[model samples]
Target: MDKKQAQALGKLLRLSREKAGLSGRELADRSGMAASNVLRLEQGTIANPRPETLKSLADVLDLDLSDLYAAAGYIQPEGLPSFAPYLRSKYSGLPASAQRELETSFAKIAAKHGYDPNGPQPGEDETE
Candidate 1:
């Protein structure tokens, strides 16, 4: 990874870990990495980490592996759409109440179309 990309990835990793309520040591333990390694990765001291290391870090940080890969200057895998950017583009300018209203309306429409996001597919048997 280039210097800029590595720095960005480190920042992203730190943010995700904090958001997941994991300390550096906790994440290192979970991901089977050394605590110093985690700190160096987060501090941008290490560039071009192995893919497996990034994957393990993503798993422990509760982040998308593809996203971590992309941030590290790798190609995003095909057919894995990252919705976060799309969501931000579509909703970032809207007010909080408007965002909630839009989300509720979309949910209602999806429900009317037999889309139960939290439930099994329409034709799937739950017992299977």
Candidate 2:
């Protein structure tokens, strides 16, 4: 990954960790990884992190792996598939309502973060 991409990935990882209300050490423990590994990734020191490592961290962080992959410059965001498929694949054990809630939350957050191209744009009237 380029320097900027690594930095963005690190920022996203830190933000997601904070959003999940977990410290770096806590996330490392839950993910069965070293605390320094998490710290290095969050500090953008790991320019070429392993996919499995990212997957494990994402699983623990309740984050979409594809997002991490995209942030890591492994894939282009425009070519990215809808994230809903990922939720379905990973959370088949979740109750139907819970899966639906995840979908709803994903959509809302995607829109809020300006990543959902199909969602209503800023200042666009949704009631139209």
Candidate 3:
């Protein structure tokens, strides 16, 4: 993934860890990783964490592997396919404004369902 994607994923993972009441050091202890490594992962300095490392993290954080991948933009969700695929299937020839409308609609739906496309909920603690 690109640097931006990696950064986004790292942010998401950090949020998830905090929401689950885990501190970076605590997560490291549970996952058998170094605290510095955890910090680097959360900071996107380590863009490509090993699959086994991710698995260990998921196990400690109680997250599904697919969910983690989706957060990283590595894989799309099952029900709501990737935006690229969706656009190609339904509005490949549409104007930019139409695409904007589609994105807006999807954003509304996601927000209504308590999913924040911007990131995790506000006022969330970064360190648990």
Candidate 4:
């Protein structure tokens, strides 16, 4: 990651952590990272963190992993299967009420289309 990117990521991490109501030490404990490491990352002292580290932070901070990956300089190939980045870019910034409304609409659409997001996966037994 470049300097600007690192700084941007740090700012995002700090903002997300605060929004999640977690202190740096609390976030580190939840994410399984060292408190000092979290501080360094938040301070932009660590330019590039490992992918797993980023994922852990995202999970703890309730952030989208795709966003972190993009911030850390990972680019998806053209024609790739994932649409998470596009969806996040389009809707992630919406207010909570708007997001909940959209989510309800999407759920209705999925049910109408016979798609059950909670259904068992292909490899799983339908009966639990």
Candidate 5:
């Protein structure tokens, strides 16, 4: 996978870990991986984690291997070309806080285009 995909996966993994209330060191210990390795994984520095390592990480994180693989942008051996649509739909079902974070991220993006959080910018057309 490309760097962008790796980065996106890393962000998702980090968020999952946080939501699960596990520190990097704790996850590392549970997975029998080095703490630094776990940190690296969360930082997208380890783009291609080994299958065994992935499995171990998934086990500790209480995640299905398929979900982890999908997060990492890997196509299942016998399935679709992309799991993004599935992942997106699943992510949409997360808790309110998670949804708020997603909304905030989009708000930041919109802000860059001169749109205010409350409404349109001055002189901006209401309908495009």
Candidate 6:
């Protein structure tokens, strides 16, 4: 990862950890990784960490592996996420009320665009 991406990844990791109420050392212990490695990741010293390492961190932090992978730039960016989810992922500091408001507004816009929230999910197996 480039310097800027590394920095952003580190910040995202750190913020996610803090949001989950885990200290770096606690995360290390829970993830069964060395404290220094966790510190290095949060400090942006490690580039291109192994998938298992990211999985461990994600598990310990209660994050979806895909979300962690996306933040780590492992996945190709897709279409825009709904506003509430995008904000929650990138800005964990947002207050709950504000997030709910954005979700409500985004739901309205999506409905106007004919996106049915209750319909079969994208790529879902309809034959099941």
Per lDDT, the best of the predicted structures is 2
Which run of 10 residues does model 5 get worst, by summed lDDT? 79-88
Q: Compared with the true structure, what per-residue lDDT tens digits does model 4 show for residues 37-120?
A: 999998888887999999999889888898998988877566543333444456888876776677677778888998766665
Q: What's the residue-level lDDT of 60 in candidate 2? A: 92
Off by over 4 Å in 2: 76-128
Cα error, residue 121 of model 3, in Å, equals 45
Q: Pick the candidate with the highest TM-score.
A: 4
Q: Write the per-residue lDDT of candidate 2 for residues 1-128, one digit (tens) a residue.
A: 98888889899999999999999999999998999999999989999999999999899988888889988888545644567877887798999899899999988987798784465566775555
lDDT of each: 0.82, 0.87, 0.79, 0.84, 0.76, 0.81
lDDT of 2 at 74: 86
Compared with the true structure, model 6 gives a TM-score of 0.57
- Model 5 residue 5 lDDT? 66
| C-alpha lDDT of candidate 2 relative to the true structure | 0.87
Alpha-carbon TM-score of each model against the true structure? 0.59, 0.61, 0.54, 0.62, 0.57, 0.57
Residue runs of model 3 more than 4 Å from their true location after superposition = 73-128
Candidate 3 lDDT tens digits, 12-123: 7799899999999999999999999999889988877877788789888888876677655565545666664566556868888888788788878887998765465567
List of clashing residue pairs for candidate 5: none
Task: Give the Cα-based TM-score of candidate 4 against the true structure.
Answer: 0.62
* Models sorted by lDDT, best on top: 2, 4, 1, 6, 3, 5
lDDT of 6 by residue, 37-121 (tens): 9988888888887889988988788788887677677865566565667867665678888777778887998889987666558
Worst ten-residue run, lDDT, model 2?
75-84
- The window of 10 residues in a row where model 4 has the poorest summed lDDT is 80-89
lDDT of 1 by residue, 33-103 (tens): 99999998888888888999998997788788778889899876565333434454468898877777777
Candidate 1 similarity to native, TM-score: 0.59
Q: Name the runs in model 4 displaced over 4 angstroms.
A: 80-128
- RMSD of candidates 1 onward, in order: 12.7, 8.7, 15.7, 11.9, 12.7, 10.6
Per-residue lDDT value at 62 in model 1: 74
